[model samples]
Target chain A: MSIKNFILFLFLTAILWVVTIFGQSNNPTLMSQWIFDAYNKKEQTAKKIKGKKVIVVAGSNALFGIDSKILSSYFKLPVVNDGVNAGIYLPLILEISKRIINKGDIVLAPLEPNMYSYNHKVGVQVIDYLFARKPLFFWDLSFKEQFYILWHIEFERIWKGYNYRGGSPLTAGFYGAFNIDQNGDQINTSLKFKNQGMFKDLERHHKNPEHYGAEFSTEALGWDYLEKFVSWCNKRDVKVIFVPATLMKHPSYFNDPIEKEFYDKKIIDEVKKRGWTFIGKPHNYMYDSSFYFNTNFHLTQKGKIMRTRQLIKDLKSSLKK
Target chain B: MLFNTYQFIFIFLIPTVIIYLSIPREFKIKFLILVSTIFYSLWSVEHLLILLSSIIINYFLARKLENSILNQRFLLFAIISLNLLPLIYYKYSLFLTFSESSPILPLAISFFTFQQIAFQFDIYKKKQQVKSFEEYLFFILFFPQLVAGPIVHYKELIPQTKEKNWGEYQKDYFNMGIILFSIGLFKKVVLADNLAPIANYAFANIETISNYDAWLGIFAYTFQIYFDFSGYSDMAIGLALFFGIKLPINFNSPYKARNIIEFWRNWHITLSNFLRDHIYIPLGGNRVTLPKQAINILITMAIGGIWHGSGWTFIIWGILHGLILIISHRFNWFKIPSPIAIFLTFFSVLLLWVIFRADNLSDALSYYTILFNFQAIPINIEFNEILLLSCSIIIFFLPNSLSISQYLKAKPKLHWYHSLFVAILFFIALKTLALAPAQTFVYFNF
Candidate 1:
């Protein structure tokens, strides 16, 4: 172990590290399956709805629950579902929504409670890494997040190599895959959910299950971004509507009914104060447990149709004024 | 600034090592003391005052004991009580009170206090030399072993301080240090962190844990703690070596031991040594009648357990181990097969860790109830269950960091192939670290 050998070892280590960092594909599609699925046909979804009068922006709740075609036919306006996964943060959701939103376009955005907390920043980056294809999207990540992505890519390349993959099977398992339809709604509902629980069991289980809501220390950054997005839309004469997330109407669903009431009122007041439209109360969108595909807001086909009909009725009455 | 962090390795360690190696020998100790103080103060500025106060107090007390001819016994008692004060207030305040909140325990309070207490006991018994304040501070605040420790002896460290030469970083020493650090970083990031999710999920939902999940949870924690502490010890030793100093090996593959006594010698060896020297022997050790010796063993181990954390679970864990050790000691008259002995020893230790990891006494009991109950449900553990099993099996056969270092040769005189292997090891460790957030070393809680 002479000085020369020690120096040589260090030199080799540095070279390897640099090479690994630079060797990654600039296109996230070439790196991970989750990222590829997210980016694939994403631009097509956005481009297809250009100049559309109405756009629905959200995460998995909108993707899984909204029936844009039904809404379009009823309102006689082209409606686009711009929802992806719930993992996307409010900032990127606003960024993506603005891309397709034009003058006089009505933007309906409902945020899932899970994405309202401080930890949601990581969730957003995870979604961006797995899906966002643009080079700019990668740069949007914090340095720590970028480092995490680079490290994971290198880890997979070196250790997992050909078998390198990342993602949760729950999303994939429910959607049959991560594919989205041309309308930008998740379509592969051939997911095999073993009905281990009957309706009563599901109801009992979901009863009082810990949920993300006002109790979650809200991220001020998310709310601030939302306000800015709304103000921007207002300047362009593009109407922005803040809508409540869909929920299962089970007694067990609202562990703190008073908290839910307070959260909804606070959210409505905040949205209205920003010169935007506030939709129905949080509990207005509640449906039976049988209507839900699985956890929280993801709706079955019948449930979606029922929800869409209710939303159309509510919108017609509200817009008439 | 955990050892596994990029900040510690690249920002703190690399720069410190470079600067230290470039400095004159006379200024090296001063630089290290300053750097160690900075590293510690990052955790909290208030805690720094606490650490410095403890150091100053112990320093004066040790010196006084050396100089005093009368009332030495009283001073010894006073010093021991004073040392225990901060540890008890910070660590056990909530347990002592019915209150929900407690003071934040200062990092390394348990470790340094124990080290200082042992130093005081040794000096009073005329077994140790009373050194200057500079040497004493170096012994206590050496950053590598500061937060979590092998419970370093003053004798072990004070001598090593003399061997370090400033501006003369030996190539062999630096290389060995790097190798050990990489191994440690890999174990913490990959093995311990990966296993954490499974253990955490099970523990958090203890009321719903099925038998299968319970066993998996306990098994995950067993390996999690082993690799976590083992990785930390290796990193500490390796970091110490960068300055041409060697640290005593803390772990010796305790899981491979065939009995409780052997397991202790292989596990946290320094603490076992301390307990033996300061507590067991002082309490008449095995020189007394069998019943008295048994009582002494129980008392020593129970104190050892409480030293780990302030909880009934820890006490129970210690009492269980003490009882098992007594049984093992008494039963050694009959020879057992190696495989059976290993399984028994490992299984007993694994069961005991459930108590160590559980939140409370009832939780530990519930875990055992579920574990022994054969009426088990088909609990689908939502984690990499296979990896947990595989890693646990691998621990039995793996050549630990110390043995791996030995195989590389004392000088670590590398052939081209050996150098390549070590380099690959370093890359894997770096890649793994990038995969997850830095996990605090498990023993840091102690």
Candidate 2:
């Protein structure tokens, strides 16, 4: 084995990797279906909302939890559900908020626990890179976020593309199995019920100490973005109300309710101090664990009605101010 | 930058190796130290200072020990303690205080500290002497073995660098390095990293893991640690070989060993040798009475475990290995068949990995309970996980990377099929690494 031969081996391997990477990148079938649907929903929402309507900006919690038709009929305005999968971090959420938020528009954002986690933010950005593959979306991310995307997702796809030749079969099955409406909400009640046991496993997995057991922090970059978002909305004369997403009440998961309440109060106070609206107490959105879908934040049909009705009351009172 | 990353391989290594190969012999060592320093500093500039300070302090101390024959023992103890001070402060500070917000452990502090301590001890014992501070510096900070190491001794490494044609590229070593590095990269990216997610999920959600899932989790970690560390060691050796220096063989299909004694001999061979020569032999080794020898083994293994991380779990894991070794040595009560012996040895190793991989004692305890409980539930196995586990089994039977490199030397011209196989493996590894999260080598934490 000579040095020249070894060099030749390296050269040939590099060429193969580059060719495969470019070749894979060109194939649209390589994109995960859920990611494609979410990207499509993101691009179409601007055209769908005709008037200065009430816009819901959130993660998958809102996409699965909110019934925009119910909100639109009740609020007497066009409602755009701009919630995508929660994997997209708060920076992108802020970018989305800034883009669609016009003067006199009402924005309802029910924040999930993931919005405040750095790890979750990276998870969101990874999804954006893999599924959306949008240049402007990638550009909109912080330099740190962009670097993470390059290293973790795009770099990963070059190799994963070889094995996952035509994209994720699980995601493809879901694309065929369930439904995503024109408003970008996942309307898969039957599928959700069918995978009830799997949902429990997922819920338990998410509740693991490694995932969310650490105490929530106010100093997260996500929280910092929250403050900036409120300020941006204030200057633009768009009414922004920070609300709590409907959560499953699992005592084992929320072991420290007192600490949770303290954090909630602190967030509400911060939002109110910025001259923005703070609607619905955290307790108002807590339901029995059975009233949820897969995740803690995703509400069941009955749970959504309970949450939506309570939210309507809160909004009526907050708007009066 | 990690060995498995594009940044390290393409952006950093390939160009550096070419430039390093082309340079004059005199500049080669200097270039390595500079790049190694840069590599160490990538984690933190402050940590790099700490590494430099350790080298500077140890270099002068070794010189002092060399100069002072009468007070060599005293200087050795003081230097050893001084060497251990930073490691103790960084690695054990959080454990001592039970604080959540402790400082980060400097990467490879344990490894470099041990390597330097060995050098200083050799000086104190008058077995070796340093010719120059630069040679000593290169020996201590050589990037290939710098972080996690074969713990290359002063005698073996320094003389190699001083060879007349040290800077000139040897075709055989270069080619061997290429195959070894590629194999290591494949082992890491394709084999170990793939197993990580499932293993992590099972361990992280311990309550959800059933009896079969526990087996799956430990097996994943068992092979994960093997490939991860062995892979890193091979890369280190390969990288060193690129500069025409050979690092000691660190792994040799360790899982194939039929007994605990054989396993230690094959696994982390350098560390095992370091322990045997420096730690175990100093404590009376096997030359003493049987019970005393047993005690020495326990002490050595316990210390070896503590060298890994700051935790009671690691200590327990070490003690279990020591006990297993003692039992294996003393007992000939039954003549177990080779297959049975290998299976039992592997099974014991698998169980021990649970303790090693768990976050804490309680975490390991919960996993053990689930493992033995035998709950009649469905095993939550993923499609890729089964494939990975099947692939991992080949590790026990296949000729290791080092041996393959040896074979390549004799048979320099690779068959077309062999070339194609290596190319495909390398291609898959590269692609997987691109798509996956940049996983730091498991040993790097030590």
Error of 1 at A88 (Å): 6.3
- How well is each residue in A1-321 modelled by candidate 2, as lDDT tens digits? 444554566567766654554454433334444654564565467566676788888877787777877888888987877776566567766665566678888888987755654432476344434433444565555677655554444544555544554543234344321356765566664334637575765468456522232545556667667777877887888878778766566554445654465445755775676566778786667776666766676666666767778888887887778
Per residue, candidate 1 scores C-alpha lDDT tens digits across B33-124 of 89999999999999999999999999988989988999999999999999998899899888888457888889999999989999999899
DockQ values per model = 0.26, 0.21
Give the fraction of native contacts in model 2.
0.35
DockQ for candidate 1:
0.26
Candidate 2 off by > 4 Å = A1-321, B96-101, B332-335, B377-381
- Model number with the top DockQ: 1
* Residue B434 in candidate 2, Cα distance off native in Å: 2.0
> RMSD, each candidate, Å?
7.1, 9.0
lDDT of 1 at A25: 32
How does model 2 fare in lDDT? 0.75
Candidate 1 ranges beyond 4 A from true positions: A1-83, A86-148, A153-321, B96-101, B164-167, B375-383
